[model samples]
Target: MISFSQVTKRYPGAGGGYEALKSATLDIQPGEMVFITGHSGAGKSTLLKLMAAIERPTSGTVLVNHQNVSTLRASALPFVRRNFGLMFQDHKLLYDRSVYQNVVLPLNIIGYNAAEAGKRVRAALDKVGLLAKEKAMPVTLSGGEQQRLAIARAIVHRPSILLADEPTANLDAAYALELGELLRSFNQVGVTVVIATHDEQLQSRLQPRCIALAQGRVTQ
Candidate 1:
């Protein structure tokens, strides 16, 4: 479902520029679960961002579901993005909104009606074991619950692909494992999963097709 053809990304600097990704190429098929691992500044996050269209590459091509995402128009970008769910290092939940509202935001943006949104939100929350916390404010929940809320929000729209970046950074070991299992379950049901993380325990435990990076290059 994803194919990167010699993709390269660079950031313009005051002098010339700095390359964040250097001719990296990879392919991930549908229904596959993959892990991306690297130390800080190793370009792991860049790869994820490129895949999610949060950043465009400086050179080469990125194709998703047969569309060359590198050439997608801004007007069509949202439609492309709607095909994948994304999770960030920080939970990025709204402290003021209820869990239900947080999950509802994505569906609302995509024009889902109240009835359908409510149903999907509940199902996603249930998948993350947070159905009971739907009415609770994000700040009132534990860290694990908040992250689960993020997961619920990401999948509430039923995107075909899921991308998570440092999802377990703030969680305890137990909760991290719980989150990994949760992601795996989603993958099992046919949502292609790609996780960018530095968590070694998760790497050793889940044993997905790991793609390691170092200094903007794939080392593994």
Candidate 2:
């Protein structure tokens, strides 16, 4: 579970700092599928970053699974991040690597042995319907396939929470719906799913607990 209490994130610049989030507070419970809906620059991305401890809050607190991430040391951040599976608007795939290689990277980083890593990589690819493309280069896949590959890579480590930022931004309607169903499936099996998107249609179709943001504040 994630909780934010009066959290604010500011970036320093001339004419005072810019606040990306203004005392925003919200809670995402374990195994819940939640959507953060807002226009561009409404702090959806900042909220996700704060939840994952990628960026420290400028004020207030952020708690993940009862740990105060706002005060966690840099060395402890990685351990906290391990519990989260992150997907970005950009596919962020290694174009030069094969799909299998891309998904296996996370396991490799955590020192998973070759046999175990191979099994996980294949399983993740299969879950995203990309098992057959394991040997293909990322550039060879279609846009939808590329996004599926990214999802495979994110879930290969079996993270407790899945956080996606504008995941369907680049996909067509059909593909976007397919991806939404895929994420919902993960939530059904108990992975906490948090998606930040502007697509009202997607939210309407899925009907997850909605959290609306406006001008960096939680408006709903």
Counted clashes in each candidate structure: 0, 0
Each candidate's TM vs. the true structure? 0.97, 0.98
Tens-digit per-residue lDDT, 64-178, candidate 1: 8988888999888788888889898887788888899999999999999899989999999998999998899998998888899999999999999999989999999999999
lDDT (Cα, tens digit) per residue for candidate 2, span 86-200: 9988878999899999999989888899999999999999999999999999999999999999999999999999999999999999999999999999999999999999998
Candidate 1 Cα misplacement greater than 4 A, ranges:
none
What lDDT score goes with residue 35 in model 1?
92
lDDT of candidate model 2 versus the reference? 0.93
Extract clashing residue pairs from model 1.
none
Q: For model 2, how big is the CA root-mean-square deviation?
A: 0.8
